[model samples]
Target: KKLSRFGVRSKDYYLYLFFKRAHKSFTLLFGCLLPLFFNAICSVITFGLLFLEKQFRLLDILFQIIIGQ
Candidate 1:
């Protein structure tokens, strides 16, 4: 097996580089956006529940607060 100057085999070095790139992209995509995505999902669910549940009147109160009525 041919080894690179770093003493690691060429295939191993390529795999290491590939993993590093994948990890960086994964961190950027999931780490930064995962929480925001979850928060948005929760907000949508809560809003839908409030709007659909007339007994709560939370959505009605929110509309009143926004329209100042």
Candidate 2:
């Protein structure tokens, strides 16, 4: 019924269907990756705050060494 309604299903149609199924299956995995990306960004901000004043000599030295600053 669906095939007739949509016309004859071809290889291209099956490929699209498979991709849609795979995307739905990995929804949870995508959700987890989003938090991981934000956590990395937040860590950068927190580090910036702690060292923003150039008060931590050790951290300043490390940053300069790492960043060639």
* Cα lDDT tens digits for candidate 1, 1-69: 334545666668799999999999999999889999999999999999877897558877988899999
Each prediction's TM-score versus the true structure? 0.55, 0.48
lDDT by candidate, in order shown: 0.86, 0.84
> Per-residue CA lDDT of candidate 2, range 2-58, in tens?
877566566668888999899987997888898999999999999997787567777
Residue 30, model 2, lDDT = 84
Error of 2 at 9 (Å): 2.8
List candidate 2 stretches off by more than 4 Å: 1-7, 10-13, 54-69
Best by TM-score: 1
The per-prediction CA RMSD against the true structure, in angstroms, equals 8.3, 9.0
RMSD of 2: 9.0
